[model samples]
Target chain A: MTTTRTPKPATAPKLDPKSRGQGWGHYPLFALAFVGLALFVLPLLGLVVRAPLTKLGALFTTPALLEALRLSLVVSLAAVTLSLILGLPCAWVLARYRFPGRGLVRALLTLPMVLPPVVAGVALLATFGRRGLFGPAIEWLGVDLAFSTTGAVLAATFVAAPFLILSCEAALENVDPRLEAAAATLGASRLRILWTVTLPTIRPSLLAGLSLCWARALGEFGATITFAGNFQGRTQTMPLAVYETLQSDHDGALLLSLILLAVSLTILIALRGELRR
Target chain B: MTLRADLHLTLGEFTLDLAFSAPEGEVLAVVGQNGAGKSTVLAAIAGLIPLQRGEIVLDGHLLERVATGIRLPPQARRVGVLFQGLALFEHLSALDNVAYGLRARGLDKRSARARAHTWLERFGIDELAQRRPRELSGGQAQRVALARALICEPQALLLDEPLVALDAQTRLEVREVLRETLGAFAGVSLLVTHELDDAVALADHLLVLDAGKLAQEGSPEQVIRAPATAHLRAMLSARRTGSTPDPGT
Candidate 1:
């Protein structure tokens, strides 16, 4: 029996990446994407274009601006540190363990991320204000968390911690359980494995979370004003200062907004690289 | 010294019940199709998974006794495992990966690194010590993982499909390295593989498993000459045909 094979093509058709999705179908998508991009870009451009550049020297010398910048840095750093200390265990448990209501617990922890900043301030006030839930106990300890710098820090932490928790939980979930098992077989304890294996493995994402948390804390205004009550050097951070100065000194407010915009843009760019890793 | 395990584990719809013993300095290779619970057996012995019932005794020390509710954690088991993926610490340098167990045991960084360097030399990859796991070739990474596993001097070593990640040529090279390195080790070793060549070449005893139960058990030659179950016969014929069976579950 003789078998004859059909003649094959002399050359296979190579896929040209440039030709991919290059049709009328992509126009609407491109148009919508550019529209969305413009929505975000326009306001930022407006901030830069409308700025009084001639007063830049004077803007840099404002005592209120300097004070607000210092408070914003200190408060955001403290909030991120607190989030790392408290949210890491929560994130680990959410990622590595299975139990009833685990999903509910995760959802509740993430709720703060979506919650309005003002509402978060209200929530904080309900829990820690002088006439609130833990008011008596807190007073007994000789501490006042309301209308103070600590209150601004608490408000920032309340709204910003969920970012760290969610990022860490995602990173933790992606970690291979087998690596931890291998570490265990090498006689490394749980704490040792977490220190030498888990954290290092998730360092990039952890840093991303920390930066996101810091950025959120730095931009906190509604929560800080509602809970901590703008007290200049004590409780008024950059965002709060921007809001206050906007009602009076418009130029100073734009300068403060630019400082915040610069910092947030830097954080977002850094976070993008971290997330890419 | 001997390592003995009688494990009965039930995970979801699958159940595993097996008992095996290997004297010190011997390699027992478990060959099975995917989902035969071969890896499950290793996990149970290594204390990564708990057995519903059964006791594991290594060198006359009870590692697990479900009846008495006494179970040692994996850290206390002193059972080294080279996972299927090799599970090398990707963030660490090859030297740091090998030194991890020593550092965990409270050795200072300088001493731990010095000892790890010696292990890297034993594996003939001392020059690659500063390179991360991702920078190494498949066979080179396998050497690093092997060095990391043995650096702690475990009482028993468990290897899960150690060669599955390698290409054909790399597999042969790694298999040769495993043969020479495992020869010098004094611990009872359990090698889990689906390849009959690996089982015959590296194992002192071969245990054929099918559907979470032991299908046959004997020396490599004995098992090959007399395939006890259909699974074993199929594996033998596949080997004869020079076709690799699917290793994925």
Candidate 2:
């Protein structure tokens, strides 16, 4: 095993021209970026400034607040789980297979994202509410979805699953099919290839998608209130509670808003590194 | 093992019709210029592409038959391929990459890793087993890919430009490694390359393809001495003018 061969010398590091210098022409773009940054931060700053910091402890201890927070956590987590279970396969189909009317299917799947939240609520009701399309069959099964916690979860999932689907599809699309082909040549079945190669390759994107879906579910308001009919300890999540307290208890509403903002910001920050990579 | 392939594939304006066979313990080199369907023939045999109207039988087993609508998947074909780019799993360590086929075939992880280590030792890459593909040099990666392809003891081996990515020194080293390995392998093997030196050095038989058809097929000495096609003649002339004569040539 002994040989006189020498390891090759390390190559010099490449210098990027773009990193060499900053030009004056970039100022306008920087300013525009700052403007976009301000657009997001200003409102958050306003919420923080108007928040009743002294009464935050008491506000947080209120029964309605605690119940809403708990409900929001449960419903959003359930929505995220449902989205991962359902959306991942849908994404794989959209990304890997070619079929007729694929464009139409993708557009329809993403429609809820741009549709008004209240309109989405109405649509859900028309499809699943009592006296609606499948309502009789569901009732025959002794299952009531509308105006229940299940309805709230369904509402959140309807709006948030699209984010997961789109992100996961993009990630799957970016995966090198050659790797899958290589795995197949090594005698791996289709499902095994997906489990060992495809899924691991797109793990970062899956995490990012999960975080986005959960955050969207956590902030769901109009749809849940309209379809689930905000009950005190069952269907009333954080956003619904904020709406209810907005008129009579402005400080309470502010506290709830602040809490939602903090939680969402924390999740986004946690996922930022993964998304960037 | 023996491999018999009669492939007829049509893509848009291009049509590829080819028929070839290789017996056990023999290396068949397929050479052609760009667009001569060299890679296509290998892919068709490997079950990566479907044949429009043909049959591929390996060791008396029908791997593909267009008339009967029978096409076994790549996994069921028991054909190993070393792709032109090697296509090593970039995220896995070299040992893991070599063990992938064994694991896929239901071997336990411990035994697979142990066998992969033995293969790595044979290839003189035992110390580099922990390195990922990106961390390995071109020659090192080629050895890992070779071990991965051969670990399954495939009935047929298809190598697509196996040494084209390496530098001259590394190419010579890898060619010697491949020559020794293929010499000892008892299954049918087909190598696709654009370099005449590769064919002359490693392959027992040569097939020259021109415009999607076979132009010449014979022993390397016969083909090189009396080239039939203009492309073959030009290649021979070019090789004659070159300074260093390949050892096999």
Candidate 3:
């Protein structure tokens, strides 16, 4: 069928933009975009291209590799769980409710996400260290977090919790406050309304936040290593494992890097697909 | 279900200092312009906003004195509100949306679902139970909103710009449904509307609000007979259209 809505091409503008009297030519914007995209993909492409294909299966199945992978999953999941426990409510306060110095609190929350991972590690060490102010007292209560698996989880959490909080805050901000009002008028207590109404409305955002938090936690390098130390079967995550292997077995490091990439990509794809439906 | 509110609430530059009451089964329609604090009154009564100084007595009990914040967190207030957009949960099915208040009140899941189905049936949208709010038409969503609010058997109902979200044709039909629904309700009803026809249809008492104060309050016949302000007159005049005024004067 010939569509009546088809445009008259004969009356269209000239093919040559130069002759059409438009001065537009080279775009710095496109150049900048291309450079940014190249920077993003270059390291990943290098790792894939330089992989030791002959020892790929062996590298993946090694006991040390498997242990590190398991630890990475455990710590990342723990970090994400703890972040949700703290971040969702912190985000609610930021987005919906208001109090004094709220702007300062929000800024401080985001600082962890943007600050260098090494700097975050230093900050955590200063505040929660054995010799630190609140740290010695907590340790005396038989809770030894430093250089333990739990320490790794804490480090990851400190670095990644901001991702969840910021994302969920934006989601909550976009929602109409009227719905909460409507729920209350219906005789639902505050907690009930949160679970039944507020939470579901912001699920897509919460999922996005959780996914970001998990990815950040999984790939955590500097913070985990500095706070918990790199132990092959305990505190060594996939990223830390890759770094340790790089100084000796180049092939092992590349294989482990690919593993980290695969794991994070699989998780994000699954979560995004689940939330889409 | 006689409710009385004597409030002095302030937000930014807008202030609401007014006193009013609506007897049980009475329709109190508040008419006002954009910035006339129409929504502020609803928000304060719903416990979404704070009251500076005054009391809101529902039936006979003081609702404003039990301060955790705004008396009771929205749920405990038991005042049904229909926001301008209806604010139906997009993720929830129509039946679930209607049943939400019931389930939130600790009703079992099975009973909540049954009650929701009943409300849906009452609103004549039973077949659309599984349909999410996003999939519903404007009129259907409004009906679901009505069912959602009314199912809780609230002691009082507050509706803000109920017809604003509907199409011209749908508004005409929905207004008739709202009138029927209001007639069945034994509780007090406060509907805020700019449309004269909608107010004249459902409201027994007309309250004209101007500059954060009650400009006039009287029966619809009296309010329409001599609209107090020029703004009120313009509203009635726009709909005059050669329709003769009642000569019962």
The candidate maximizing TM-score is 1
Better of 1 and 3 by TM-score: 1
Best by lDDT: 2
**DockQ leaderboard ranking:** 2, 1, 3
Q: Write down the lDDT that model 3 would get.
A: 0.84
Docking quality category of candidate 1 according to DockQ thresholds: acceptable
Q: Residue by residue across A1-277, what tens digits does model 3's lDDT show?
A: 1111112445756597557544446567667979999999999899889987778878767898989989998999999999999988899999988899999999999998889998877777777778766798878888877778998999999999999999999999987777777777877777877887788888888898889899999989888888788988889888888898999998888888887888877987789775575
Candidate 3 or 2, higher lDDT: 2
What ranking of all candidate models by TM-score puts the best one first? 1, 2, 3
Provide the fnat value for model 3, as a fraction from 0 to 1: 0.59
For each candidate in turn, give its C-alpha RMSD to the true structure in angstroms: 5.6, 3.4, 5.7
lDDT of 3 by residue, B171-238 (tens): 76777778888999999999998776678888989888887899999998988888888888887777
Candidates 1 and 3 compared by DockQ, better number: 1
Q: Candidate 1 chain B — worst ten consecutive residues by lDDT sum?
A: B240-249
Residue A204 lDDT, candidate 3, scale 0-100: 86
lDDT (C-alpha, whole model) for all candidates: 0.89, 0.90, 0.84
Error of 3 at A157 (Å): 1.1
